[model samples]
Target: MTKRSPFLELDGVTVDFPIYSGGSRSLKKTLVSIGTGGRIKRGGGRISIQALKDVSIRLGHGDRLGLVGHNGAGKTTLLRTMSGVYEPTIGRVRASGRMATIFDFTLGLDFDATGYENITLQGMLLGLTRSGVAGLVDEIAAFTDLGGYLDMPIRTYSAGMLTRLAFAVATSTDPELLLMDEWIETGDADFFQRAEARLKTLIERAGILVLASHNLALIRHYCTSAAWLEHGQLKAIGPVEEVLAAAGLSVANAALAGRQSFSNAQ
Candidate 1:
């Protein structure tokens, strides 16, 4: 059998979320009249918000694609669509590979459970078997450095500690297709430094990566290509530099501005 190449393709995909407004008919009518940020459609007396509209993209092995746009510009929605979290209202999404998503680190976490227990839970949620998660226990624990805290209920842990625990478990999976909502930056400075290195390694190992971030310099540094989304539509896409230019963003300027902000904070 021939080896299959990893690829992801979205064909005229549009995602609509139905809005259930339980109120008097007058209230529903008012909402429809006022409209919302997303495109609103009314049918069968139900209102729906179109989060993605006629968007199409194709990515193959070695593709590092960055998604750029303002908040609520369908960046996260597109990532979810690619991850099969959201079925398109129309059109198709076809992907071939082992996929992992880092959208929400705490997605499958249980605050009432111990760190070790949550590790098993989250790992299983990520498609690992019981034995598989057991095998990763030591490595995940070492990466988190939670130590005795792993035996204690996670609710007793601090926010940063929870982030450390969740992030460690989340990144344990080796994926051919990796989808991330934003660059994973959590925990204390020291942990962040280590996490950054680990994240870079993961990105390098992935056959295809789709990252949605507001940091233009980070995108330029990691991505070969870029896609610009606006109002739930693909506005532009091409080489990183070209797409950034089209989006009115300059990587150099963004980096300089970041430095200035840091210096001012100091």
Candidate 2:
């Protein structure tokens, strides 16, 4: 096969937010008047966070893309942009298949509700019909292993309980594209073992799986290709071994490291 073009394309993308040291939000009363039209429409009010910069990427079928970056290097922003959470301030994002993003410990979990109730709520958020959640309720609750606690309020559950429920529900449907950021942070070794097994199954089913994490071993073993992103741009992109070698990282057989790749970007 000659191989096909990417199912998704992002060319010359950029996202920027102003650093309102003064009162940009209150500037309406201080500077520009109402309906100026020509001036930038930041907001009706002020203070902002410049979360992302000029970032661009492309994804094709069978691409297990890994995103590596520092704490605020815009990994989450890029993932959100890819998933249509936040529209790009510039450039374009064209994707062929449906995209799903799994960020945060219990992103859509309702704390006031029972584990059972939250599963239904999360399924609804994932766009699953009532019958869909009802069908999977038993499965998700069983995997969570919270026993009868499934009937208790989510606020009573620990972070680990919430994580298990979230992962179980999200993976049950097998989305076309799966985007994740540090998804396994809430479990013990035994639970992680089970979660890892589930993740492997998920990767096998999805056409594209993109994950961003500081976990080196996870990236090397799970992802076939990795991209080092810094200052909102891709520094290096290639096979796990090649990119890690260029960054002077051993990544040992079972080791992880910090974002020591900025030197190579210069």
lDDT of 2 by residue, 150-193 (tens): 89998887767777777787777776788887645545887888
lDDT value, residue 150 of candidate 2: 89
List residue ranges in candidate 1 displaced over 4 A: 23-44, 251-266
Which residue window of length 10 is worst by lDDT in model 1?
Answer: 257-266
Candidate 1 pairs with clashing backbones: none
The estimated TM-scores of all candidates read 0.86, 0.82
- For model 1 the local lDDT of residue 75 reads 91
- Candidate 2: where is the Cα deviation over 4 Å? 1-6, 27-54, 252-266
Error of 1 at 198 (Å): 0.8
Model 1, CA-based lDDT = 0.88
